[model samples]
Target chain A: MKNVFRFLYELLIGKPEPPMETPLYRSEIFPDVGGVSLLLITLVLVLVYYYVLNHVMRTARFSHWYHWLGMLLINAGIAFGYAIYYCRLHEVTPDSYVYWFAFANAFYSALFFFLFSLLLKWRSYNAARTPF
Target chain B: MAKLFIFGIGGTGARVLRSFGMLMAAGVDIKADTVIPIIVDPDTQNADLNRTVEMLKSYKRLQGVAGHDSGFFKTDISKLADMDTRGEGRVKDAFTFDFGGINQSFKEFIHFNEMDPDTQALVQLLYTQDNLNSPLTIGFKGSPNVGSVVLNKLINSPELRFFADNFRKGDRIFIISSIFGGTGAAGFPLLIKNLRNPNSGLQNAGEISSAIIGAITVKPYFGLQTENESVIDSNAFITKTRDALAYYKNNLHGVNGLYYIADNPDTPYENRPGGASQRNDAHLVEVLAALSIIDFMDYQDADFGEETLFHEYGLRQDAPSITFEQLYEETLHRIGQQMVKFQLFAKYYKDMIREDAGKNYYKALNLDAAFANDSFHKELRHFLENKQWGYFAWLEELARNKRSFAPFNLSTQDLNLLVQGKPVSRSFFNKGITQDGFVVRLNKEERNLTSEANPNRKFLKMFNHVTEDFYTSKMPGI
Candidate 1:
């Protein structure tokens, strides 16, 4: 019962650990974290990002340019959280190169914004061409 | 171009012609290239006649500014004189013929006092003293005997000759009159008899005499507020109608199509003979009478037999007050949708368009200046609020009356009222449609063309396109 409880707690809140046996865990991207757990967390974050992006697009009309920015900020916030989780799980101190490298992974969130804004722009352009 | 020369015979005739103009404005199919309305009434001061002439002129002005071949005001009605001129202009061209030298007492018209004693004695035997002495400036006042003499000169007039001279091969004639009244009853048969005469002394007498003809004889549908002494009486309407119908059964000729319309006298209008007080509410009978013209045009010439094709308006169910459901499916399909759509368009301009005047749609259509203090806007307002025969008043009266065509769920409270069967429940992304929904739908349906720069034309064309789409969307069968 304790083992089950511990596993669930670790899966949800996550835990610090020594390097795992898998090469993915020992890879340059996230050297001290468990590869499976990191993948699971990233998958969940991508889903959450997609869900929030959909909600904004559905509710907010693309009349103003700022709506696209607002959507980007939401996705960037989620991507930044993924970087912070990697830093915590890998035990990378703030001053190290790996710490900055993992933090730089936050820029990946730009892809989400780029793809999101592109879709939004395309929809708005088509809408402008097409009469109501 | 085939023209439909409509002879609106008297006060009832003038009123029905006014309803026909209103129908034409709403984009009803009149099936004529030009509609030449010749109002035949000896009463120069008759209110209904003057009002109808004024309305026909307004319709002309609106159609003039509206682009060529627009669905709105598709039927072009020119004055009898202007039909000869290409550079036609002005509203005061006058649709009514000048009664001229006939506005005096019937006694003066016949030179009763100067006649020999033997002739005077014969005139006394033929006409009552009051009938002879009564002034004709207002009308014959239910005295068809007096009306017969005054209206007979119409067939020989310069206007009739001009009309006959221009009459083409495929051109047709339709007459409107009331069976119970003086002028209409007397003038209808006289006009027909003269047209059928072998020698009308016009340029195309043979063709004009044998022309395909349609007529609507309106029976008494309302009572007078108070009976006047030398005026019409509602009590005698049935007896007059019976006598007239009996006469028509034997003598009515030269007409290929005939329509009869009457309503139970449930709502009586305020009685007035001349000037502004003579406007009557739009009735179901008159609207159906107007529809008979449409049906007449729809029939091929071969369908008309030697005897006149007689038609009477009927409802799906007999009710004192009718809703959209009580109308025949064919009636609903033909006119119900167009009426509702135009009502919505009119209401949008009347009630809901002020805030929206600054929108892209208004700006694109160039209506911003017109809606802002322009003469065109004033003309539009006059078309809507012209005390007696305006669009808004017509719809309101039709709605309140018995045998209503309650197609729109109109109200003082709800701006969001749906057209009869439109869904009240919201669709996927749309909050249920309000009157604003019509404007939104209009935006979708309006053509993207910018060629016609006249604001009035743009407004008319856009609405004509939009209402068609709006109705078709609402009623799938439409």
Candidate 2:
């Protein structure tokens, strides 16, 4: 147990050690907020995330792999940890409905914004075509 | 000889031409007048062009391309036509080439020495002020009124062609302009598209009518701030540039590679100067783009390093007030913000596919219309995969080396060091690219380091092959 806690700490700092037990430790960190707040935060996060991710794929070509890869790894670590916490660590554990509804809501909202940004400017929120 | 008829006389087009002009003035150092350029601005070049040529001319002609291509108290584009029609040597000479192009791609270049007696006499008369800009019997969408008259008179008839017969195949001809305003933006594309029917550029010389063409377009820097912009929208201009490229692809029968320039303008104009100069650095943008196109198309070499258009393009100012180094540093900060955004997106991927399904996630990002679809994931993977023709390849080729799309590579720091007139550090560089350097920005302090004579001759330790004396000469050949 001591060794497993040490492994999880190392994963956060970006070390060369194996992560054999860290995933399990991370499972305890997820918190499945029951009711409306969980849904609201998930919805907001999904839309914001979708917009940003697409922007990176389009323009991140300007720098190095670490610039992008480092960011991706950190995000995945947090979200996946959150997933484990919600499904296994908190409350009586989430049913399949929790996973399905949360996932569908996040994906749909994000996708809508992603398409909208392409057709209009976000700053002015103008609907005019970019002319290209 | 490949003759490239570039269309689009806006900021994008003019900046593209500057690269070709700089190469000509700088002289790439290969013997035999290699490539020849013919300029056809619907009017005259703008203040930014006049100033750049003024600077480059010092290395080649300092006082500027001189008598006719003069800067300071310059003549307007409209009056040049009157001068050309009136046997005014400066105006007529401004439009004609003194020698055969380094290559014979321009079909109707109006070669004078090779003509027979009667034809020579006709050619001379055709070249005179009264003939060249004569109006056309039947006008098109953007015809120059008197210029058309002169063109019809010189070509003898609207049906006949002069440049077509003069051009030979595979000759590299570079057409340059800036698309934001004036002659370059309006005239460059017309000159390129018109060449297809064999009536463009006076149609005066030989028998080969058509030749292959290529283009290098330029986009303004992200901030692209301008104080004196008349009718400009930097965002709309970017979109128009894309449409123009698509237009070239759809309209022009044949064109090879469309290179781009996304750099700051390299000029001395600042808050003090107000001689009708383009504040957004549009001219410098056009030239950098032109240089990239020539290197990619003419040389078939494409591993260009990151170039910062704002800071490194000129050695004029002592220490620039607003250079590309700061701009690049800011750019990286923006990229960092984007990383946070993408991390948030991982949640969407989580519900859509399994943890092991890297392939499915990538597909959903690239090709799919829906966020969770396979195409979108594929696209994300394609970028992450760093495939041969993926986004990385494009970024590496165009932006990683220089903020501007100039052929040579100089990081933002390197650019700063060069501008400071400091020597470039080759110790770590000689050992090979450091892993961390993959995202370095170019600055202006390293200005004259790349052009110096090395004492240790240790440059080979850094670059596999050095970019030495690779510029074309200012002297033209027939």
Candidate 3:
């Protein structure tokens, strides 16, 4: 065994021969670290969702399910952008941000448009029920 | 016997005159002569202008000024069709008619100010326009050949002749024009012909021994290349303007002393010519040209010699031996010319000092702001900050005065955008501003070259607006 080790060491090229026996495993695997990071992110996202839900319920600002759904969609879009571009990549640039920063309008307009439409519809339905 | 006649040709000209008139009243104390210049302009009907006119009319000295020499030198449009262009008739549209009430109001103003028309010998037209009534909408709509129309009107007025009769021996007359466009170009010849003519353009036609006319004609600033081909490439228009100026110079060459302003072609146009450099230069030239005619407080021209105050309404001299354009390369660093130079400097080197590691805010502040940074936008802002007369002041005034009372759904993001730096947006030109954040924030430059910064005609349009406001309203504190 000692002779075999010495012969293998002789075959080494760049570095001086190792003084100790080599271990097979790396200190940490990238996939494990990545999964743990992803789990923490999901936990935070879930908390944010629940907090927003609780706040919405307390305020009663959105009485309808559609409004809640719309808000969720919009928030989701923002979260997606944050997670992919900002949180994960950690990017900050005036040039990258200044122009073409108009994506937020889509989500906002969609939610607002539906809310306003629902408000109008609700008024009509209430009036019909009361026989004004 | 003295007359102060100020004619505002286009927008910039009129506004400058308003300031000039205000300055004259507050600064130069004219006794036994006209206190207020007779303001001639087409925008007399504007509500703001009427208010200003009423205020001017209320001046007690204004009455005495007119009472001493009170005849309206109304312009005569050879044809009735000329009056209908801007949606009015010549009887109502003409300067004489539009300002007639103010002329009548002089009875009260002059008495209050205690002044008289000593000699109605000189007249100044602040109405600067291209050869026509150039409406600067994107499509170049509503432009009529107002230059010829106005020229004909002035030449045919009987009051002009009556005024010329007032000029006595040793009296002097000065006509100032910047050799840029229509009104000045056309008016120069008309003024020279009548002034020098033995027949009867001046008050006392023979009394005028000498005349001094100055023009601050800005030659083409080379930055014009980036401008829209439709506007800048109109060679026919340019040639007409150029040739008319040339003719005026040749005609007036021998009759008077001359000075001029040349354009600094090196000015940067992040967008194009006529914006940061061109329009600013135009206003500076026009205003400085107006100031050039002001007799200095201590400046007694020995050559004027035993001058009697006389008024000349109708008589104009022929074109002289020198044109303002010919003198452009030499003496007279007219304000407009200097402004062009500064714009050029800022355009080229504004960014250099900003990048220097050792430069501090104090150090940066000491440098000429116009050229301290490479960014034209920053340079423009800097230029305006230093010189109150640049485009920044005018834009602020415009945004302030515009009657934008409509309720808008605005957010911090939106407000930041309106106040924030964006190019001159064609989309937003007169529409105030669009409401979408995406529309504003999405674009890389925020505005397309022609659509945004108005480095070309948009800047000039701002100057023109001031001119219009000048004739129409009282000065708003900026």
Candidate 4:
């Protein structure tokens, strides 16, 4: 999981911010941000949109393509903010590479959100055909 | 699988049949496998008859698209001519009986001009000058003496013979006519007499003679406006009803079940004898009279005895306006929920379908193109919202007429307060019945109805399920 996160972030933004911080970036920040923000948090937002708001509460107001897009944007925003917060918490070298990594995380968060929606929306009563 | 042949005899009969058609469109339960409505009005230009025919045609088209298993349009209403399985083409393929146009005056029709001197003297004594000169094209003009003689020839008509030929032993016959008018007051007894004659030479005369025959004679429910030049006088309605009752008590036989209904006259309708102008607003009496047809079909064959069973409708309490709570339990059981469901379906179609273009259920069925281009949707729209004589217009007529039957709060846009006396209970968490909730329920029902292949059938079935859920969950004490 760590190598996979390292490969995804590096593929988008190239190397880490400073040559001295490369090991910390690969060892902790990449995996921590990618797993929590992109995969886990995106999955949770998709489930809340499809299952909780639609099926459990049975609301049709949010069962639209635009509403789904809004949820995806929100997940991306959360990923962007979490990546910046995690990087600062680690006291990494202040550079443009950290911002680039957060940008990559936000982009991947949107993709994961779309993937999760397709997987979980079929069983939703009100939003099954939404965003089609 | 017995069929019910309904003979609607005049203007009142046509209006009652219209109400019955509305009920059948709402998926109200009827015991018969098929219903054959034979409208028997000689006034071909009558507005009431024309409107009933048009509504029945629309209903037949929708029923063709949505099969019997779907809740709405569940019953099959067939034309009398369609019953000829052999394709004999003996009768006209129409809802009304072919009268062949009685274009002559009554005097000319009876051949009084060619009578001998002694016969002419007797005819002059029996008929007034106005009665003798009245044209047959407009109808009897409140004169049953002329109608009785004219309608007696009905027994020899080709439609009667065709009806007799197709009637099976288990099938039942129902007749609807008013006791205060000319055509119905005169035609009802003649029809009963002919159908009861076992020796009548028709093919299945024996079966038809012993069949379970029911008739609802609607008494005077509305009066005519006073017109100095008009032959129909409002003052004579009670006298005519009294005379007809006396005649019916002694001479109206062969009916296994006889039902009588009436209401006090409140407003006077225009005194148009019989033409396109003679259209009257629908009344509660007609709707209840239509219910009698359903009630008659509910009885088992063994329920009928040698004596003719008689019935009269009475409300729980007499009021100028009636709601669901005012009806008896039996009446409510017969039609309450079905009417409410159909009304919901109609209201949604009229008010919310346009806004629901992006709904899951709407997109699943591709209702955007269907609503814009499909004939089924167009017919459904016409059935519910047409300005002249559609379902909403029928409801409005009922509400504005004397002794109003306004059970639904039609003017309000709020779905929670739809039923007049039975409002949906709402809570902080539960908005009882909103447009959003309706769409949600419809989406759920659409998923459940995936197995129904036809879009028209699925549309009706989906609404049926959704409205049923709303009725059960949202409306309490219904």
Candidate 5:
């Protein structure tokens, strides 16, 4: 069970063998649990987002254009905040900020968040349309 | 479309008509295409009359805007004034005939002072001083002597004439009145007499008089709260009813069908002679009386015979209070299913709508603004929340009575627990109605309904469709 949990954790955060020796970021000040903690936080944040979305969809028209826009903005903000925290944890160099990989992380996180939120909203909409 | 001219006379008449209107709103099948209700009461300010009139107006307005697509509130109810366009156009635009000159004492109404000494002596011999001095504003106050005189004039008025004129051959007439009351007891026999009178000088008097007439004589089912010199007494109800029935047995005419409904006077209402204080609770007996009219309409023309057919209301056992289980199989099939369906519909609107509104079911129907904000929606809510005779109050009273019709637990705080055909305690365990089961059913039912862009129209049609399907599936026998 411990090995399975570790494998699952590693699969979510990427291969554990990879070193933080890239040009954009290097491990120095942050503890070893930094990567796991950040991943856990992201998981918690996603779960909380899903919870709220479920609640709002129960009684509110969350699929309206304005509501979708609002949801997109919130998800983007969360992803960007997490990206900034990830960079700060690894202590990215100021000169490496302009690197392609530097912004790619944030872009990928935002895309994932956007797609996940969209999927949830669509599911609720479908559930609503389906009669008992 | 044949019309059913329902003459609701006095307080009891008004209450029965109120039940009929509610049943119509809930989509009960009344074979008539149009219902023309003409209320006859001298007391214009009577609470039961006013409440019934207001409810009828709401039903009319709601049915008007709801269009023809929805099955609920499908029965067309047009005012007598609206139907007759041939006159000088001096229409009152009201359900009740104008009783303008009846707000005076009986003596004043007859112009006692204008009579000579010998005529006055004759009038004095015919009527006692109390009968002559009695006011006609509140009502006859159980004095058929006064009511008979006052109500006889209405039969010859232009309103009755217009009613007789506009009435087609296939159309029908039904009179609702209480046998123990002054106005109804006096008016029922008088109205029938005028309708059947061969010499009555009115357009199409013969055809009108000979129309297939049905009348419901409501025996005194309730009593007054307290005894007072000026008010009606409970002790007299039995004697009055017996006497009235005997009179009907001897002199009743024209009516081809008659329905008799009454309940034991276990619960007495406040002792108000007439006016606003006469507002009574909705009883199961009144609902049964309304159902009788529907039953009458369901019959074929060939069903009528020369002899008048008589019917009476009954339950499974002579219990004090009645539950849905206590009803007879036929009664359950006729009234139970429809009652529960409408009860579920009302429960969904009154309790579960807010939470369910956020579901995809509403969004798919393009109801993002919430159908609650619509004017028709507001009007319906207002109708159900009416102070005197709202559906909620009606059901609550029915459940609280001796023959309780407590099919749903309306007192629960949880919207999820609101289930039809089951008690509140058993709502959780009931099949086809779990916490989320109704919402799902609503969502599914919306897909099946014919789409209407109007949210109010869609809301009513969807509820009408879903509740019917649900109740029918859940309790097929009912």
Candidate 6:
């Protein structure tokens, strides 16, 4: 799972920015941010969209393609914010590497959101055919 | 399953058949497997007959796509000519009985000028100048005397022979006519007489003579404007009804079930004797009369006794306007839920379908393309909302007529308040019957109807199931 996250994030923005923080970035930051935002949060948001708002709430109001896009963008924003907060919590060197990693996380979160949507949307009552 | 052949005679017959078509389109449970409506009118230009014919044609088209088991247009209504599967008969391929265009005067029709002097003298004494000069094209002109002579030739007509040829042993017959009008008053007894006559040399003479025949003789329900030049006089409606009743008491025979329905005239209609301009607003009497057909079909073979069964309709209460509450349990059980469900289906199609284009149910069926291009969708729209003779127009006319039958609150957009006196219950947690709620039900129903291959059938089945669910859950009291 950790290697999968590393490959996905690094594909968008190459390896960690500053040379001094490469070990910390590879060991903790890459896996932590990618696992939490790209996999966990994106999956939760997609479930919330397909199941919570549509099925549980019994509404088709938010089942449009644009609505799905809005959920994806929200997951991306959360991924960006969580990366910055996690970097600060670790007291990492205040450099552009943290911001670059955040950007990479945000981009990968969108891809994860789309992938999760395709897998989960079929069982939804109202959003089954949505965004098709 | 037995087939029913309904013979709708004259203008009142046409109007009643229109209401009957609406009921069938609303998915009312009619017992007959097939209903063949044969409209008998010499006035081919009569607006009421033309409208009923058009509505029946549209209904047949919808029934072709909707199928017979469920949904709108579930009842099977076929033209009499279509029953000629052998393709050997000369019956016209139309709903109305072909009169072959009666374009001459009544005098010319009877060959009065060629008659001998003594026979002419007897004819002159029996008929006045206006009666003789009355054009056959405009119909009997409230003169049953003229109607009787012209309609007596009906037994020999090719249509009657064709009907006899196609009729089977278990098939039944129903006749709808007005007791106070020209063509119906004369045609009803003549038709019954011909059908009951064992010697009538039609193909199925024995079967037709012994058929379980039912007839609804609509009495005077609406008056007409007094036109000095017009041959019809509204003041004479009661007098004519009294005379017809007296004649029917002795002459009318062989009917297993005879239904009598009438209403007091509250508003006067324009008295155009005949033709396209002589359209009358639909009355509650016509709707009730249509119900008699359904009621007649409800009976079994053993239900009828040796005597001719007689029936009369009465409301639960005498009110100026009617709602579902005023209807008896039997009437409600027959049509109430179906009518409400159909109204909801129609209102949704008219008011909410365009906005619901984003709904999953809408997309799953690809309704956008179907609505724009498919003939089934177009016919459905025309059936529900056509301004002149659509289902909604029928409802509007019924409401506008005196002793109005206004069961649904058609003016309101709120689905909860649709049924008059029966508002859908709501709670703080559960908002009753919102547009969103309708879409949710529709979306859920779409998944259940996936096995239906045809898109049109799927669309109708989805709405039919969803509306039934709403009726069951939301409007329990109804």
| Better model by TM-score: candidate 1 vs candidate 2 | 1
**10 residues in a row with least lDDT, candidate 3 chain B:** B70-79
Q: Which stretches of candidate 1 lie over 4 Å from their true place?
A: A1-132, B86-92, B226-230, B273-276, B373-376, B402-405, B412-432, B435-440, B444-447, B450-455, B476-478
Candidate 3 structure quality by residue, lDDT tens digits, B276-334: 22232222223334454453211344532333332111102212211222233322232
lDDT of 1 by residue, B116-233 (tens): 9999999999998888988888788877888889877787677777788788888999999999888899999998998888697777888887789999999988877765652666
By DockQ, the best candidate is: 6
> Which candidate would rank higher by lDDT, 2 or 6?
6
Instruction: Give the per-residue lDDT of model 4 (tens digit) for B1-478.
Output: 6999999999999999999999999999999999999998888899999899999999999999988988999999999888888888989999998888998888998999899999999988988788899988777888788889889879889999998888998999999998889899889998999899999888799999999999999999998889999989979989999989998889888899999999999888989999889899889999999999999999999999889999999999899998898899999989999999999999999998789877789999999999889999999999998877799999999999988999899999999899998999988999888999889988988999878999989999999998998998887588
Q: How many residue pairs of model 1 clash at the backbone?
A: 0
Specify the highest-lDDT model's number.
4
Q: What is the C-alpha RMSD of each candidate to the true structure, in Å?
A: 9.2, 25.3, 25.2, 1.6, 7.8, 1.1
| Per-residue alpha-carbon lDDT of candidate 4 for residues A1-132, written as tens digits (9 for 90 to 100) | 999999999999998968999999999999999999988999999999999988998688988889999999999999999999999999998898888988899999999999888888999988888788
lDDT of 6 by residue, B102-212 (tens): 999999999999999999999999888998999999788788988999998899999999999888998999999999989999999999999998789999899999989
- Model 6 ranges off by over 4 Å: none
Candidate 1 residue pairs in clash (backbone atoms < 3 Å): none
Q: Per-residue CA lDDT of candidate 5, range B378-416, in tens?
A: 777777777666778777877776556565667875533
Q: List candidate 2 stretches off by more than 4 Å.
A: A1-132, B1-14, B23-35, B42-45, B52-91, B95-170, B177-188, B198-208, B220-229, B242-246, B262-275, B279-287, B296-478
What value does the lDDT take at residue B315 in candidate 2?
22
TM-score of chain A of 3: 0.26
How far residue A99's Cα lies from its native spot in candidate 3, in Å, is 82
Docking class of 2: incorrect
State iRMS for model 1. Answer: 6.7
Q: List the residue pairs that clash in candidate 5.
A: A59-B358, A131-B444, A132-B440, B320-B402, B321-B402, B321-B403, B322-B403, B322-B404
Top candidate on TM-score is: 6
CA RMSD (A), model 2: 25.3
The complex in candidate 2 yields a DockQ of 0.01
TM-score against truth, every candidate = 0.76, 0.33, 0.32, 0.97, 0.79, 0.98
